[model samples]
Target: MMNRRYVPDLPEQNALSEANFLRLEKLLGGLKNSHYDFQWFGRNNEPVQVHAEIIERFKFTSTVNLIKQNSALPKPMDRVQLTIRMYHDARMAEVVTWDSGRQLSGVYPYPNDRMYQIDEKAQANVFLGEWLAHLLRHGVAEREWTPS
Candidate 1:
């Protein structure tokens, strides 16, 4: 019996990307505004900040960083960072590179280089969707977001 390796569903991945793009676009106020401070409480009830910023605009490159200012080296949660690319024409968004500075491939052969999961790209996009959802749920923008 041959082991069934995972194959990516391009349509599903694209759908996720498309949904994420709309969520992010709304979060960024139609990509007109930049900066969302996602405030959440730590175990001690201290406020923590998850900062989202539009670092670049041409084709919309953005970075979401969770580092705390004036603090020591961040913990893994605090160190989560993602470099995202937004394709307005395609109405899609993707994680171009992750905190480890590695680009996730669309599909990977089982036991392939770096031992990445076969559906890494789709997983990353799903992760991005969750992040955007969390931000939309708890984030506070510099200005109120309203449909324009």
Candidate 2:
């Protein structure tokens, strides 16, 4: 079995940073249908391949790190880390985050928007897009990462 611990102030950590979000805005502002492949943890204990359209006009903010804890799965899984608003909606200041090590923890609001419920399909699209951008900019080479 896995251990799950709740941490305080998860929302603040996941919110997007200002500079990064501006970069996203610029990219999305001029985006064309470019195909990009990126990998991230899925709800299951495995890597997931995400494919998305690179919109070049949408803006994104930045993210903050939250708690680091283990997953609820057995051995061989990575710890779940939380981030505060990694992205903000242009129309509204909605904060979103990417929760590590947990499956189905897609882009979500951090109690900022009182009535705005996250649509899973939409969240997946946004997550895939934002995550792809992040990986392309910061992902370590596959050859460099070795299992500990």
Which candidate ranks first by lDDT, i.e. highest?
1
> What would the per-residue lDDT of candidate 2 be over residues 1-148, giving only the tens digit for each residue?
9954434343442343334455434433322333323354545655543332322223564333322223444644343333333345542222234344333333345443433334432343344446536655653322211112
In model 1, the clashing pairs are none
Off by over 4 Å in 2: 1-17, 22-33, 40-45, 55-148
Candidate 2: C-alpha RMSD to true structure equals: 13.3
Task: Give me the displacement of residue 99 in model 2, in angstroms.
Answer: 14
How displaced is residue 74 in candidate 1, in Å? 7.5
Cα lDDT tens digits, model 1, 89-137, are: 8888888777747777778887786777787777778988997887778
